[model samples]
Target: MNSKKMVLIGLVLTAFFSSLAVFELIPGLLMAFLLLSVGIAVTYYFALSRMRLESLAGISILLKAAKEIGKESKAPEISRQLGLWAQRLVKSEAVLVWWQGEWAFGDEEFTAWPGLETAREWVKNNNEVLVLNQNGGEIFSHPWPSNINSLLGLPLMVAGEAAGILFLLNESKRGYFVPQDSEALEVICQQAAAALNKARDYQEVEYFYKEILFSMLNALDSRFPGFTGHSQRVARVAVLLGSKLGLDEEELRILEYAALLHDAGKVFFLQEGLPGEAGELEEMDKELSVLPMEEHPPLGAQILPDEGVFARICQGILYHHERYDGSGYPEGLSRTDIPLAARIIAVADLYDALTRLAPEEERLEPEFAIKEMKKTMGMLLDPLVVIVLEEVERELDEIT
Candidate 1:
């Protein structure tokens, strides 16, 4: 009962029992009423205090989750953190969060959790939170854990679009998630959605920037007559080689960008009308690829944006033409002095140049290209990179 109603009831009991005692009708009954009233009042006060404390705790946790979510900028990392927070917020045994991808937390052995997929679809279609509990629903018909009779599914909206779904499953003696639990989760989802949108925006901007860079690389390819798709092919091979060599994601990314832009420097020195068709380059212009050593590598490095994330990529490009035994271009840096990305790109670049369908004098048969690469392994290319290249070639051969 509400505090006002309880108070009125207590007062009425007080007067009723006191009247009996005043007439000496039943002093014992008056004593019993006094004890009962005091007990009820104390119990009511503690219950209210407990509810207030629980509410405050939920608010505090929500704020904490928001603060942590704001600190992450990567989509995957943000999803992970948010999933963890949701699990904690609802004290759920398992939480599933889905954005561009999905993450599951807690004990996920319950494969038969009914209505999960349906709930996801329902939230997506309706763009609203849905709660399922055993209070009066058929959703709990499926055999569930003794304590897990409720599911709270909230749609994570980003920029007016449903970006993801957050599910909280109850599997404890706490009975089931109540309406207040859903309310608290809704507040947390608001913050999570904002963070997710911010991270997604950052990702989209990065992707757009990379797209422009790729276009510029393609334009550079058009200038080299027979090398139209050389950059992209080299990048693909380089990524494959980098993976075989155990390069981490960051390293592979740098290698891919460098492979695409490795020849960007040659664009500055092309003679007029030199970039027409295959074999259109005059004999004199062909010599420019080898001569003027410092020009292309350093020039390509200078051509790339050196102030931000591309700086390392520029380094990779600058050294890609360097020889493994200190006999190559620009810096003549040998072995370990050459960046690993440059080493991997060098192998990929040379392999593509030899095997791709270029001029009659330039292109080599696939078998011949492999033989030629093996011949130059330790002298012109890093031995480790060449090994990865061979692995990639073997895999490709099997696929063929």
Candidate 2:
């Protein structure tokens, strides 16, 4: 109830009980005692109600923050964003995030605090939220920072398993971290724990997916020592060029898949007949059959599942060898008629093919690579793709 209504009800109860004692209708002692007792009870109830309202307000903030972190599906990004949310969670100036019992990111100075290790251990082992203050009895043997009067540590636990902890140091406008502050942090921690677990699962699946692709590509390249690593580099550079060209998330996903699987049609000729167990595939280093090199594009397209998501990916893989000027490939697709993903892979594939022939230290310099790349910009590769390649090369140069 609102304070005004509560007060009105309290007045009514007091007046009713006071009249009973004043008139001495039965026994004055019991009547007076009842009035006093009722007054105390009403005041206590009012205090509890106010606290409940404040707690509700805090819940609102917690939900908003949790929703923001929920949208991310990558563990590192989730942790980075968690640090930002931590400061707001408890109105702290600095926050340190720990994962797997080690510092992952956030304020480095929190690592300097003497009692932090002890505090963190307590939190992790107990899987609970801890609020510490210099003025309170929980004060540690080591001195605390003068400006900082309080500390809060919360473990990120899911299913009773703790993966990380959040430590907020030296609270600001919110005063000391209170029960409400720690409670807010706890809610966000749980949400983050779930997100972290999901992100990790996604990463594991992605790692295996890429590993399988590399295995197939390895089998295809087993015959040509100079051409080893060609397909992987093409996939890497294609994604980089695609990103530079402003392809959105889905486009990049398809582009990357197509690039990785572009040479997949040649996998069958690797003596094993098909890409087998990763271990078995690695051991069989037999030479590839002398198949028509130009046939692999159409063969790759046919091999990939053309249903749902892989449909566009297959098309891209199928026509990666097609040229911009209609002078190349199995279908002679020209210019934009070639799928964008294929066009991107085409540029990346040729660039890597030209440079990956030598050992790393002796490989063609990017400048020389680009000079060779420009020779077939129109006749052999997508013209626009080569332009983006130039920018990709420039970026690499500046980075190196």
Candidate 3:
């Protein structure tokens, strides 16, 4: 029976004996028997209740940890946080977690106990919880440390496979951890495994998306002779400038996509009269560049998805060629009316065109290129964006 029921029974017996004793209807020996039984039962019940409360408190902490773990997006970070939570839940002398071939928490300092390798192998092979007591120091693989007498190892199961193990250690208090501790730890490990799996899946998806983006950029570059590296160079320089200006990751991403695909509308302009080969266009075809120059920005915007994250990129492309002095084509947005991303791309696009696309003899040196760009800062480019570009150029010069 549970402690509550046992305590109730003891209380009833005591009341019955006290009533009998008061009326002189019970013997002294019988009264003594009832008194001892009541004392033992009440004491046991209180102790049991305290232990149960402690377990509940531990479980509560674990639940809070699980909620926090779910919000993380990386496997190593999830595992690290899980280890910390596990340590708090158990109040163990040490807590160590191993996941994805790396120690997530409680490294060499906490793992000085013997039989760790044995415990790790057991959990890995059985995919179950393993608890060990230093009974006469017989259960340890090495000479048992005098301070530590018990260890608990729990499997972190993910998708029917063991993802890792959580090891908890206790100081020389024999039988320090009970079966309930193991069960509570199992609950925590299950949540950690789920969080780790989710982080891994998210990372894989991000990697796949990046691969596709790079491939598309390469295919677009192949369409223009002598422009195979132009988009990538622009992307690199634009990102540097964006970083210098303190643009956050999301803003930098938009700027990057806009710069890489700024000239995408050129692909549509490859009609019968345009020289379509990979080399620089012949003098006769130079006039054809003007045909797309007027419409490429809008056409490039139309080439991307119309809504969602790419919308910002589309806006950047559509206004990339617009000038600060209202002399640009299509919409002629002037000054701050132009999007910042487009302005940054405009500077990057001009720099690459001057250095990489100009005829060999006509190409200017890096120092001269900065002077040429300085002439149109307020007229053709955003002055602030030009300043950032100038900083990037200076850094590049120092590096070279």
Top of the candidates by lDDT: 3
Quote the positional error of residue 272 for candidate 1 in Å. 7.4
Q: lDDT of all predictions, in order shown? A: 0.70, 0.72, 0.73
Q: Which digits, one per residue and each the tens of the lDDT, describe model 3 over residues 307-358?
A: 5556778888898878888777679899989988888887877777666667
Better of 1 and 2 by TM-score: 1
lDDT of 2 by residue, 160-229 (tens): 8678888888754446877667766776788888877766655543664567767777766665555566
The worst-scoring run of ten residues by lDDT in candidate 3 lies at 282-291
Clashing pairs in 2: none
lDDT of 1 by residue, 295-373 (tens): 6778878866674456878888899877888877778999989988888888877777666634567667767777877
- In candidate 2 the C-alpha lDDT for residue 356 amounts to 55
Higher TM-score: candidate 2 or 3? 3
TM-score of 1: 0.50
